[model samples]
Target: MTAHLPVLQVVIPLMAAAVCAALRPARVAWAFAVLVSWTVFVIAVLLLREVLAGGTISYEIGGWAAPWGIEYRIDVVNAFVLLIVSTVGAVVLPYAGDSVEREIRRDQIPLFYTAFLLCLTGLLGITITGDVFNVFVFLEISSLSTYTLVAMGRERGALTAAFRYLVMGSVGATFIVIGIGLLYSVTGTLNMVDLGLRLSELTATRTVPVAFAFLTVGISLKLALFPLHLWLPNAYAYAPSAATAFIAATATKVAVYMLLRFFFTVFGATFSFDTMQLGFVLLPLALVAIFSMSLVAIFQVNVKRMLAYSSLAQIGYITLGISIGTVTGLTAGILHLFNHAMMKAALFMALGCVIYRVGSIRIEAFHGLGKRMPLTMAAFVVAGLSLVGVPLTVGFISKWYLILAVLEQGWWPVAALVLFTSLMALVYIWRVVEAAYFHPSPTDEVAAAVREAPLSLLIPTWILVVVNVYFGVDATLTVEVAGRAAEALLGVPR
Candidate 1:
């Protein structure tokens, strides 16, 4: 059973998703989805424990050895990612029951749960697989389901957003496939570990750089880093709030993980950093993404859209850490991956509760929410404070590491820019706060009628907010895990 945990993490969700699609009753589908997600979460926790205590676990699918057959490799890096993805699904599934019932059509509920489970499966498969081609397969699985899930939004624009994402996402996936094909032609193996070994032998080849270019562009699109992020705001804005919260929390984080896996694991530091000089290219782009997107987020009228752009800016922080390419820098990047997941998930879930009550997520809709829905507004405030990098919030821990990483490279100017961006975050967060608390309600009826969100949504949403503060105050687990994961990626002793 222990040896089979790798396959179980993904298989349970994949199989359960099919069952959900076939389930006649929507309630049953929800129950199955929640069960599957909880099981995956447990498997992920066990996998992490094994990796931390015993080191990497390499499970050859069907008992075939790696390089010849598909492999599911569990290591500290992917184990942490697995935990993040599965944990989000576990939380979101229960929350989905209430949120989906309100926003999605009753007849469509089963399909929504099916798509959600499929997305969960794909993310876990991408994290667990050791085969390069399998990554593309799992990526498409997630991307396809994500499009369906996004389009299920009651908003008419949801279809358009899903279409746009499908087009852009398809192009990104194609580039990744082309890059993988090029690597396969050069190295003659689809297994990432074997490819890594062979790739070192072709350091001087032109195809190597071409493959790198294709991969970097492809992953940047998937992760929605800066200029390539046009598909993100609308997708988040139009999707059902539950879909927005789950995808916002996990999707791009998984893409960022893929980038780290390929850049550090497959290509190696020497080729990626020294030969290709990725830092020169990525550092500038990341900086642009941080400042430019934050500026754009401040001007948005829709609160959900504003938070979507803020999500893009946060991705810039993760990318910037990778661009630095040192152990401390990588640690910062990886840690932010986890921290931002908690903060953004909590924020979006809070917005979902607002949408449930007011049937909208516009800044105008939140005119007097603080007085009516104090607990919900408080959750938003806590998450917003974390976004602004307030002390004792997960956001502060991420920024602290980012600043330390920047200083490690003697780039005081860049460090200052990071601080400046935090102030920008504060400005945008303040906008929401002012609207929620200070502004008068649009009407007396709205002020009189508004109440707190149902307990189902509030519980999951606040659990994440509580986690944001809890983890912020106690960073031992996150720091230790991320630090070791960073060392492993850098080929240094933990």
Candidate 2:
């Protein structure tokens, strides 16, 4: 069982997703999804522990050898991502029961859970697979399911958002497949390890560099990095709250994982940074995304859309860390990948709670909500504080490392901009806070009607809230894991 954990980690949720659709009563499907998510989460924990205790774990399909048969590989980097994705799924699925009931029709509920599980499976598969082509396969699975999930949103705009995402996503997928195909053309192998060894030897080929460019652009689009991120805000803004929370937390993170995997592992860090100079290209774009998107988030009427824009800015921070092209910088990027997932998921879940009661995530919908939905709003504030990089929160820990990484490079101006962007996060978050706490409700009837979100919703939201703080206060475990993952990717001695 332990030996097969890598395959099992992906197979369970995928097979269960099909079973979920056939289950009677949408609630049963929801319960089954939750069960499968927890199971996957436990498996991820086991996998992470296995990696930490030993080292890399590789499973060959049907006992076939590498570079011939498909392989599922687990290491500190992907194991950390698996933990993040599964952890979010476990927490989000539980919250889905009530939130979905409120937002989706009863008949559509099972379908929603099915799509969620499929998306989860795709993300996990993408993270664990060792084959480059398999990455494209899983990317499609997740992308197709995500489109379905987004289209299930209550608003008509959800369809438009889904369509836009599909168009952009398909183009990105095409580029990725072409990239993979080109690499195979040159190297004659799909296995990442085999490709890496082969690619290191093959030099001065125009094909490899072109393939690298395609993969970079494709991945940048998929990860919603800066200018390529137009699809994200609307997709996140109009999707079902549960979908938004899950997708926001996991999808782009996995895509970024693809970036790290390809740039650092498959291509080798020296070739990617020293030869290709990816850091120079990524650095300016990341800075633009952080400052520009943060400013955009401040003026939004719809809080969900505001947060959606904020996500682009947050992604900028992750890419910034990557662009610094140092082990500490890479560690900060990866660390922020996990931290932002928690903070943003919590914020979106809180919005789900608001939508549960008020049917709106517009800023005005939160008027006087501090009194009406005290716990939910408080959770929002804390998560918002975490987003702002306040001390004793996961957001702070991510920023602390990022700043340290920037300063380590003596990029003083870049470090100051990072700090300035935190203030921008604060300004946007404070806008919501002022409305919720200081302003009066439009009507007493409205105030009377709105009450706290149910415990089912509050529990998961607060679980993440507690995570944001707990990890912030004591970051020993996360930092250690991130550090290990970074060192492994950089081929440094642990």
lDDT of 2: 0.95
* TM-score of each predicted structure versus truth: 0.99, 0.99
Residue-wise C-alpha lDDT for candidate 2, range 231-330, written one tens digit per residue? 9999999999999999999999999999999998899998999889999999999999999999999999999999999999999999999998888999
Q: Give candidate 2 regions above 4 Å deviation.
A: none
Each model's lDDT comes to 0.93, 0.95
Summed over model 1, clashes come to 0
The TM-score, computed over Cα atoms with residue i paired to residue i, of candidate 1 is 0.99
Clashing pairs in 2: none
Model 2 clash tally, residue pairs: 0
Clashing pairs in 1: none
The 10 consecutive residues of candidate 1 with the worst lDDT sum are: 441-450
